[model samples]
Target: MQYRHLTAYALLSLSIGLSACSTAPLNLPAPHATETQSLLHLEDQFHLNNLATHFPDPLAITPEMKAFVKQHVPESLPEVGRLRYLTEALRNPRTFGISYHSGLTLTAAETFEQKHGNCISLTVLFIALAKEAKLNAWVNEVVENQDQELLADNRIAVYKHINAVVQLPNKQVVVDFSDLGDAYLRPQQRIPETRAAAQYYSNRGVDMLGENQLGLAYQYFKRALQLDTGTSYIWGNLGTLLNRMELYTEAEIAFREAYSLDNNDHTALGNLERLYLNSGKKSEAKQIRQVIVRRQLNNPYWHYGIAKQAFEEGKTEDALRSALRAIRLDNSEYRFYYFAAQIYRELGDRDNYHKFGIKAAMMRKAAQDAE
Candidate 1:
């Protein structure tokens, strides 16, 4: 099962829970008991107690995708000159989000034929074409002001709008959808100081860390901290690197800084506790865990992480219990069901195995449909 599919399963389960709840009391047990039991049954049937089982390894891009990218290569390079063309394309009244949405809905060939798309679609197109042209280009996930306004409706809805940035001989230029106006377009603005920039660098650091280039990744995270000192994410990244490097003292400091910035950053707290324990400071680790327990009373991810750790260490019963707690807190996270499914499969529970399998399959299908 794919991670996306697992996510879909979680979402479907949540949807069912939300829609099924009505003001009228069912002819069941107490209201709270009925709700709790119903959710638990749904979780068991779907194997939501185990998340790791549902996530398949990431797949390689298809040959067809590569061929499509090569065939419809853009004529212009993704440099400063391309900004003018992008602005001019945006001027057409029809070339708004709707147009871009259509382009993204279709394949690369279809989008190339249209020659116009929305900010996101255009950014994708630009990145694809730039890659084909062998130009240094990447899609920057920025939180725009428009995205901030949209968040009033949903906080978890990350404003993942894409924009293009080109590295010129002299300077870099930002080709953003929002910057496209009627009059002569202005020069690309200087890189601003924001939490988003911190996130951007932290993500780069993560990528580097994945490649095992810890030193480079640490530098990127440092740069991220310089850009936005208030961001807890950078501190988290820094702590992760320090831990990997076995710089226990520095790692603890970084984790503490992250916790100071956002007490809700469980990763930092967990890392700090781990570091304290490794350093033989068992009392300090216990104290930190106590603090974490007080703050993370209602946090599902904390429970999920603990469950995952237990599962990995061959403690099936403990893993199952922890996962169940996590699922009870937030049934919408697909990983919970995925993990539960794995545990059931291990215990030879065929009925539950199939139930969670179907749930995961359905969720994966939904995600593919959305894409």
Candidate 2:
């Protein structure tokens, strides 16, 4: 399984978008002049040390990295040719292929040694190699179609799939390390190296958060915000950390800031809803949930989840309704059609069952062919 997939009870959930203009119970200001000061104060107040200097540089081209690049990328080749050679060399199992490793985010050098890293480490390694090879390559953020899974702690782990891009005069070459097909990946924008580095820090923060290292996670999130304050996910992660520490007011402010940056960030919206519910603001929580439902009406995965749950509970009619809605939202997902077939089978609708069953099979085959 090169690409992550959802089994039963799985929510093929996309990030829910809430209206940024929606009225909120909290009077939070947009990030402004005092933003840096507030961030610094948080660091000072927590008595945390600035450890960015000690962290490994994800894009640093080590001696071994340089040697690998020199051996693979020919100096005589044109820029495009060199890029092609380097990409091919990296993916060739005989040369240097990196296996997909979740949760472990390594630097370029570490990834080279271990031959295993998540998407972030792989992207960093590619950028490093491209730098040594003198190719114009950098990290491109995939804005839409983010892959996510539910963690054991009931937190959603959103996979921010990033890949490297080489811009040529005629065509652009994308170096994707993941097995996700074109249907699942669409590069939105090219981010600067600093933001890419911030991603490394944020990933570490998430790892620390998962391991219950509160202090360490705080520092990492702070470091990430210091590097790139525009990224909503980092702010949302900081909010999560603060919420865990019982800093409700600060967490609410952080979550609001995250929502302000990206109105479509469902995670931030969901976090805000949770905070509201925990604080016993039932009215506010209900309002936020309504907004989430309105936004998620366009998300097929949410409907699929409802369908799956209803089916498991023996409500075949309700399951069929949600399943059909899922298909209407996104017919490309074979799982939706497959689930619909199951519902139809349970209802004794043999004709529709066979119809959906055939469609599911065809969709699956088409998806495989695209890959």
Candidate 3:
């Protein structure tokens, strides 16, 4: 985990776009906001000896997916209301549709074949079905802050929540796989399709990096940034990757760009703080840490973050208590379920682990069912 050599010669920062008329990334012009840009070519980032598996195509819509929708949905469904009918149709198990599969990025085709996936994968699945039914559909991402997950294998997955948004002539409906009703909720900001695709690829890259597949991960991250460079976390991920390679200068720049893009990105702030602390910038490091402490005091997720730290420290009881406290602060957050599962595992309470696992599954299902 050597880090201290990555410095961008220059950077091309892409502007964030969110409007009623969002455009396609393919048609998007290369952003040249600066005189020089970092070498963003895929070849520069990838040099794998074994490049057997290619990246999954995000826009893929297979015939199987379309035909499945046709077989279940009535052909005579009025064009304007197809989205609503399909939504109801998905809720029935007899209709031969979606189930929940956790982890990784699966394409619509893979999800359709597998019959289940996590919210991100499920949303892609649902949106594909909606599009086949002739309804306008796209992935909708909710604005998230201080919502990050520390996954297995030293990998961190920043949460950029996704749900299906189907546009109707009369109304628009949101299809969520993690229904958090009347719970503490955040206002959603729908991302363009390309941005959504970028998120998927970025997450897949995270998993790949966890596997130590640096070459493939680099490719994935490049593609993600190419699709939507405005994503702060994606840049942060790139910075983290560079850090692992000991590209500290480049990593610092990347992290700062991430924080600049989104002030709430404590991950970037934390990383920057570490860099500054190591570089003898004690005051700068402490200032960032203080900001985080002040913010976390009011953030409901503060307890969960503490719980994660406790779990890592091998303090079972403290972890469990903190995890529970997080739930007490906000019961609707699914991350708490994950923490509780970890605690139960540590306590060797298989029954409680299974119970909480089932509870989490059901909560996700209720969201998918939009119940």
Clashes of each: 11, 0, 15
Highest lDDT against the true fold, candidate: 2
Candidate 3 ranges with C-alpha deviation above 4 Å: 1-36, 39-55, 79-81, 88-91, 147-155, 179-185, 278-283, 298-300, 303-371
Question: What lDDT does the true structure give each of the candidates?
Answer: 0.48, 0.72, 0.65
Instruction: Note the residue pairs that clash in candidate 2.
Output: none
Rank by lDDT (best first): 2, 3, 1
Alpha-carbon deviation at 361 in model 3, angstroms: 21
lDDT of 1 by residue, 1-371 (tens): 00000000000000001112112211111123232123212223223345322211111223543554444344454544454443444344554211433212222333355655434445445555545545556545443222122212221111233455666678655555443221012222333324434544555566567688765666666666666766554666676776777766555566666666666554555667777778898876666566555544455655665566677779888877877787798775555677777877877888886876677566645554643
Quote the lDDT for 244 in model 3. Answer: 70
lDDT of 2: 0.72
In candidate 3 the C-alpha lDDT for residue 39 amounts to 28
Runs in model 1 with CA error above 4 Å? Answer: 1-220, 237-256, 271-287, 294-298, 362-371
Best by TM-score: 2
TM-score per candidate, in order? Answer: 0.41, 0.78, 0.68
| RMSD after Cα superposition, model 2 | 5.6
